[model samples]
Target: MAPAAITLAAEAPKLSAANTGFMLICSALVMLMTPGLAFFYGGMVRVKSTLNMLMMSFISLGIVTILWVLYGFSLAFGTDKGSLIGWDGDFVGLSGIGLTQLWDGYTIPVYVFAVFQLMFAIITPALISGALADRVKFTAWALFITLWATIVYFPVAHWVWGTGGWAFDLGVIDFAGGTAVHINAGAAALGVILVIGKRAGFKKDPMRPHSLPWTMLGAGLLWFGWFGFNAGSWLGNNDGVGALMFVNTQVATAAAMLAWLVYEKLRHGAFTSLGAASGAVAGLVAITPSGGAISPLGAIAVGAIAGVLCAMAVGLKYKFGYDDSLDVVGVHLVGGIAGSLLIGFFATGGGQSDAAGLFYGGGLSQFWKQCAGVGGVLAYSLVVSAILAFLIDKTMGMRVSEDDEVAGIDQVEHAETAYDFSGAGGGTAARAPQPAPSATTAPNTKKVDA
Candidate 1:
């Protein structure tokens, strides 16, 4: 007798070439944001500290990359242990994870997901560097990030994104990283600035940006790379959500730039290049989380509000005497909060989540959830960052010596300068050799008849 026909179960999740390719490209784009950030921060600093500023951002790429692979990813995305943090040993060195293993619902391999998230981790610490520009020691900066990423970023990423994490389980809606990346970094910046104090010439010297063109170029790059940041968060190329996010990103960024320029013109009587660059960044930060949730019109509102609010917020440091070097607190912290909270009011419930916002007739429930997420991250980051800064200040010393700072941190810290006026045609043109010391003239008298 023939045996009964055997039935086969549906196939397990398999890799999708399109999704893998999309994620890999997104990772590269996200990686570019770090160097773009280096240029942005570099150009904002005085010439003497330009290279140091660039180095501060660049070093995070090196340091965080190593740490991420070793144990950072596991602590961030590994199997959740009570939702506070992941088990570091679960994926330490990416052990026990096979090349063919797919990340839960996504079609990409687990490694691809890991690397993509690694880019986010790399930039979060670098974002803090802008606040401490020129003042902190390079060695100490390096050490601080290594510690901060471990204590602050890893756990925060888990809280916001990890499965079963408190924020994830609590129904908080952070499509990208409004809370984990921007707010976390911004608050950390403020904390360190409070401990490190102001730059030597804060509020007294001009401290103008050495190169506005460099900053403009950096802003362009950041804007270009942000497509990957927001759209790629979807982890798929074919999803309409990515397209919505992409369009919202562009629209919001443009609106924010225009709003900032208008505000600058009205308040300061001039629309400056610096304002344009900064406005663009503020828009980028504001749209990061809300892009996936809100409509393009809502994005315009969010961007415009963030632009105006952050422009005003930048002045808060001067009033409060915090000396936030590059306005990280102003742009990132304020913009992030604006975007995250606005989602509760503007979310259309048309994307991944079904939760509608207040304007969409969902009421104030989502709004309150957003407030809780924002407040929780802000408080946790501020306290932890302050403790970390204080400990480092006590142990290894966070600031350069006064002499080193006054003379220029680039030469003292990195033994290199961003520019050199010692070239053959440089150095004040040699004063034309002083015309042979006016040989025909007396020491104290005017020249005689030649």
Candidate 2:
């Protein structure tokens, strides 16, 4: 009887309450970034759409959070039947993942891990909306996010991060989400931008930011929360590797900020606040892919390159006549590719850790692999995103009417105002507003010929 009982005993894993607590906090930290994005994007747009811009990020909190708990997690991280996607496990609807269960070889409660990742899933799609701002109907945007997550993000995440995922099997290392988050969103942003067409009077319009101060504040908040983002990828405290990644994040961000300011001073004769914030974000995106794999020096290089390339890429839309409103493609897509490829050259140690590049005598093998990986991801993302956008447009329509767009999405869609310049203490416009001596606002005109 004793022998039989021993045979029947389940293998219970030891649990760590402290790790669970740390991870739960990390999840909350990542959640804060969406609002950080709200302010970041809000300050970049015209004053009329300030609330609407922020609401795009706010809406993700409601939509993706609920979907992630229901099935997004299962589809994203569950056991994969092949290299492409995962099967529905009992985790769907979070069934049987109780307060006491283990997850992904961690000692923390599974629920904590699930919620932590869910926040990442929620904010990723919201990041892309900046590329297609000021024109999409609110309802159309909501539906597009839902379908995009279900079809595009989930499968790509499974391919990169899930058990038996193709990239994981191929030794493609992403500490937090260089490929899944940045490159995927970047390419998808391009797809939607092409399908949706340019914003009204893009090149002709001066289209200056209504509030640069708000954008700076948002950048500060995002930088603060990123400690959780990169470190939390380790999913615990007291982790030396996580500590290294944390340090790398700060180092890269500072370097990129300095690099961007220097570039601005060189080109424009003055350092702009917009350049500082954008540079910080570029550095953050570059460090994200290579954070766990490279050294501090590698991080600095990645950040510097990302800063320079992204600053240059922002001007491409003007040259090529595509309106990438907020430089999502410039910063995220270009930065993501730069980091992923640079790691192939800079990686140290041997076996899984040693991904040497052309300079390191590993020859062009690793570089080619990196190129293939980047190309594959970009091609797949662009094609699938276009298809998804087309479907959504065909079924539910994609853009708001020209009249609704002119009126501001806040008034038409959410029925709210971001500011009250009226004297009556309400949101009404001032009846007898006099024009300022100088026009701080850039004129809304078509700047480039299409």
Candidate 3:
């Protein structure tokens, strides 16, 4: 690692404590988003399994933080041996990263910066498990995350952001984490959902959300924290590009909200808060890959298109029998692909975006590159996630028993409940009621549809 005082003469202005401080705070702000995700996902599930949903994300914070300190940073950003993975020779257990430590040219205490980036690494995979909720065992999940982070996330993150990775060599312009975060997670989410199979009563039960208000609150927090997520990609203050990313974030979100509502009104017969919230997230995902490179108008188009595509994609669960419990496949995977592909034609250079879409005649080179990046991440993630899930299932056992599942994971797995408003009634009040027998027919009558 470089010393804090070491300066590159021609590498723009060096990062200062003021800039570093802002970034450190932003990094911390981004870290809080995982818990925000917990609340968002938890609120969308049945009340019985709410705590289990929240636990999935919280566990990542505990597990990934430790892993990052161990070797996650070293493997991700260290010197490149080949275009495969980073050579793990420095900053093990936070040894070389001093308070005044420097690396990657910008100055921040390397420890602080590492912790900031670590939060991103931890949450990305956790975000995908939303598709497999209420099924997997807690121990099985822990083992899966530990393995998946090393196998899937760390390698891809290195390829995109680390010096020795393939995408870095190929000039793939993922300003933040379009491929690493969204596409990788989205593909993995799809894999796990398929492996887990549909939830027991998916189509038959009315498994509606316990609280929309909580879901809305979680989405709001994610939006606020995302400023740090998107803007902090620059890693320093006073970068002209950081300001541009910030503006694009809002523009894309606004367009996405409008587009989602318009689509919902046309198809569902009513606009829903869920649709708006989902649309905002779609915009966020779409803009993630192109935020720094594209213009405000480009962001608007990306967000609008992502909103519509993701909205349409969400309905696929009904058409196909996948049951990606909360539409992770629809929103993150689909939206990530849409944004990545669109940016190829829309990305501009020379402070003027002469780069028009295929309809406007930019041809197919950029589009093909974007597709290549997307396809590579998707293929790798599916294979790795399947292996990891299989290993964990065989070792620790992937799911709880059917009886425990019927009783709810919150009570069985965690010994807790999201709501305690039943005084002492507890399980009786919380449990679903049984239907009484009808007196119109004899109790002994054979109940036959035939």
Candidate 4:
């Protein structure tokens, strides 16, 4: 293994206790988002399939962490390899580095940065689980995350964030994973679903979320943790960029929530809680890439745009005939694209870089650059992810039996259920009255959507 060496920041290489401590807290917050996502997805699934939905996300915490320590971090942040990937024998197993060694030019110990980035690596694939919920086998999902993280995520992170990465060098301003995390996971979700095909009885069965409260709690937790996910991307608060990111995160999320509720009321006649929760996430995704670049007012516009766009997008599956069980492709993919491109119009010259956006007289130059990053990652992830899913499906079978899916994936896959209504009320002597089937009039309620 090669020994770790220092590449000093132009300013001093001295470690700041404040920065280190702040980042450590931020890492914890980001780590919390995985479970938050699990709850978000878990609640959206049918009662019989909730555990499997939760497991699909929680398992990534285990699988990706081990991989990150083994070689995932190395492939993502090690020495530049042809500006396409990273490589450093020293980074494998996170060995050969001293305790105090800094990461490139950062103030925190290399360990802190690795763990922080590891959180990102962990959740990116978990984000895809939302779309594949209830239909996939646990074993196949695990294997797929392993391969997808290594084959698709690691290299893409290098491409967008690592030093000497092509997109980074081209000045594509992804403040924090508009491309690497959200867009990549969203596209991969679309790809895998395309290969696996739709869930059984897609349009026939009423696949509404079993628990909106759980989804709401999950969304709230995600909103809380996102401060860390966005602000901490600046590495530290030394330059005040982190503070701006924090502010913009809040501003944009609030705007998106309101925008979505208004749209829901106008179009559907009532604003549902699911719409509110999903709208919040849409804003979060949209603001993630542009928060550090745009001003607060600009953030409101981005959030509102993404809110409506994603709200309208979630229905595309029904229109186009693919079953994205959750709106992963809609919110994450579309929102990521909106946020990344909006940077070209909203980036103020005072933020992350001096690149003036179109509204600020930067012209169409930066917009084209943003398109390159968005299009490149989307195309690569979609094609490669489809291929990976196909290979995994062919080898071990990705979907469970249709009978098993109908019965409940939790019982088949995990041998457990989220709730046991069987023994309720001491196996009640008399059953409660069941709802009446249609006799005179069929209800025409609008189905609740994610």
Q: Judged by lDDT, which candidate is best?
A: 4
- TM-score of model 2 (CA atoms): 0.90
**Candidate 4 segments whose C-alpha is farther than 4 A from its true place:** 1-10, 427-450
What local distance difference test score does each model get? 0.91, 0.83, 0.82, 0.93
Native-referenced Cα lDDT, model 4? 0.93
Model 1, span 1-450: residue lDDT tens:
323322222344568998899899999999999999999888888889999999999999999999998999999998899989997574798887888889988789999999999999999999999999878999999999999999999999999999978999998888889999999999999989999999887887778888889999889989999999999999896659998999999999999999999999999999999999999999999999899989999999999999999999999998999999999999999999999999999999997588889999999899999898899999999999999999999998999998899888999999999887776473565645654556566374322110
lDDT, candidate 4, at 73: 92
Q: Would you list the clashing residue pairs of candidate 3?
A: none
Q: What would you estimate as the lDDT of candidate 2?
A: 0.83
Per-residue accuracy of model 3 over 291-397 as CA lDDT, tens digit each: 88688888888999999999999989989898888888899899889888887767765222244446445676667777888888889998889777877777767
Q: List the residue pairs that clash in candidate 1.
A: none
Tens digits of lDDT, candidate 4, 137-160: 999999999999999999999999
Q: Write the per-residue lDDT of candidate 2 for residues 1-450, one digit (tens) a residue.
A: 697676665444458788888888888889999999999999998876788889889999999988887888888888887788886667789885766878857778888888888888888898898898888888888988898889888888887778887877776778788888899999999998888888776776667888999999999988988888888888765547787789989988988888888988998899999999999999998888788777788778878888888888888998988889898999889888988888777765332256666556677676666676677778888888888888888888888887877677678878878877665553435455757655667564464211
- Model 4 residue 2 lDDT? 28
Runs of candidate 2 with Cα error greater than 4 angstroms are 1-13, 350-365, 424-450
- Candidate 1: worst 10 consecutive residues by lDDT? 1-10
lDDT, residue 322, model 3: 89
